[model samples]
Target: MRLALVTGASRGIGRATALKLAQQGYRVAVNYRKRAQEAQQVVAAIREQGGDAFAVQADIADEAQVMALFQRLDEEDKPLGVLVNNAGILFTQCRVEDLSAERLQRVFATNVTGAFLCCREAVKRMATQHGGLGGAIINVSSAASRLGAPGEYVDYAASKGAMDALTKGLSLEVAAQGIRVNSVRPGFIYTEMHADGGEPGRVDRVAAMAGAIPMGRGGEAEEIAEAIVWLASEAASYVTGTFIDAAGGR
Candidate 1:
């Protein structure tokens, strides 16, 4: 079976992606930093579907833990075929001037540095230059990167912008080596992440703005997951260094 690893697979977009990939027949490695129970629940759900899955704990922001995550995979001796850098965080809405250095550091540490580190490892394993089979990487970015997310979390937007750059740059760097890199930018998805932004009902509060979107509604995690899975699948074999804006016509 092809092996796929998804970071922050405990919930939200990550969870949905994990389950979908499992259904698509990839033996999944569900990565979570904490939320062990939730991660295990995802594994259980995948297994219940007659799919192979295991949970691995790692703070992708921490280099050591990320290394350990790969170490565990090495011990299992599975050749990775797909990677979903879906782990990210969003702080409470605030202006750029109101944000502190620590907050910026924390946000970039996970959103930017974390994704970078994971991509580095995946490239080493999946790149033909490294004597391994080819694979695909799908970075979970945000439409906020394009909208600028003014007055909200510019830092988060900036971080995702960096992810977009990484997707393009890395796709070029590894295209000849059989690795495809892409991104999916989701907008106003109904996930608990808004609660982390200090408003559990933020999406509902912002629903009035849906008129600006051609679709006139917030998206769902599953919708984003479908795009992600397709990008990771062979149907997208000739696709690379591009992105799917799963945002509702934002």
Candidate 2:
């Protein structure tokens, strides 16, 4: 069975992507940092649907943890066929000038460094000629990178911008090895990250702020999941170093 390793698989886009990949016949390794129970629930749901899945915990920001996570996957006898670098954290709401060095480091640690660590490991395993078919790395980015996310969370936007750069550069470097690298930049999706920001109603606030979007509403996690699954599948064999925007016409 093809195996997929998805970080932050406990909720939102990450959880939705895990379930979607399982539905597409990929045995999924659901990676979570602290939400063990929620991760298990995702695994259980996939298993109940007759799909192969298991939960693995790791903080993607830590190099040792990321290495160990991949080592564990190797031990499972499932060389990774796909990787989704979805684990990330947003900084507390504050202006750019008010952003502390600590907050900046925390966001980049998970958003940029974490994705790079996982991508590096995935590339090592997938680029090998003996590791079944070559794999793909899909980084989950944000449209805020372009929107500039002023006033609210520019730090988060900058972190995702780094992810975009990683997507482009890494794709070119690894294209010859049959490992495709790409990114999916989603606009204002309803997720728990915003809930933790204390405004569980962020989607509505976003819609109010960006009123010009043609789609007229925020996106759903399932919507982004479908895009992610397609990019990882053979349907996008010719696509690499591309950014699939899941924004509702923003």
Candidate 3:
């Protein structure tokens, strides 16, 4: 089976996708920045179910750390066929006037720049010209990219917009190289990420508001995972540079 690397695999969509990919027979590399314990648990759970997995650590925001991450995967002696760029960061609610340069830099560094580095590395390994067998890259964007996350998370929205552009540009670049690139945009998903926004119940709060979500409910991490896995699977072999909005009709 080919190996699939999932960044931020300690929890949320990343963890769910890691488990799902393992179920599909891919040896999973659960990458975590500081959540070693949770990452290990994911690996343990996969092993318990007769699936293969291992935990790897890296702070995607740092270029050195990102390089070390792919190097670690290189040591595994397995062909890397799938990469899930799921690691991202978001700060608490703040208006545009209150946004700090440091905050914007940090968010873009992780969500955009870091993802670029990961794709670069993955391409080096998965591109046919590089002697690789080719593969798929699934970037986890957000619905905020389209909705603009108006009052809050504007910076995050912009970063995801960049991710969308990256997915399109990179897909075309590697299309003939036997690689496919795509993205999944999830909206109001119930995950630990909401706590990062200083609102642990943000999803519920928004979904409760009149007409906030068309489906009248927040989405789940597993639902987003399914879209991501499909994009990385053979079923989407001919699909590239596309986005799956798994956002409950929002």
Best by TM-score: 3
lDDT of 3 by residue, 68-170 (tens): 9999999987899999999999999888889999999999999999999999999999999999999999999999999999888999999999999999999
Candidate 1 lDDT, 155-217, residue by residue in tens: 999999999999999999999999999999999899989989888887766777747677777
- Which portions of model 1 miss their true places by more than 4 Å? none
* Model 2, span 142-207: residue lDDT tens: 998888888888999999999999999999998988899999999989898897766789888768
Task: Give Cα distance to truth, residue 242, candidate 3, Å.
Answer: 0.3
Residue 249, model 3, lDDT: 86
Task: Report the candidate with higher lDDT, 1 versus 3.
Answer: 3
**Model 2, clash count?**
0
lDDT of 2 at 61: 86
Candidate ordering by TM-score (highest first):
3, 1, 2
Q: How far does residue 35 in candidate 1 sit from its true spot (Å)?
A: 0.6
* Candidate 3 root-mean-square deviation in Å: 0.7
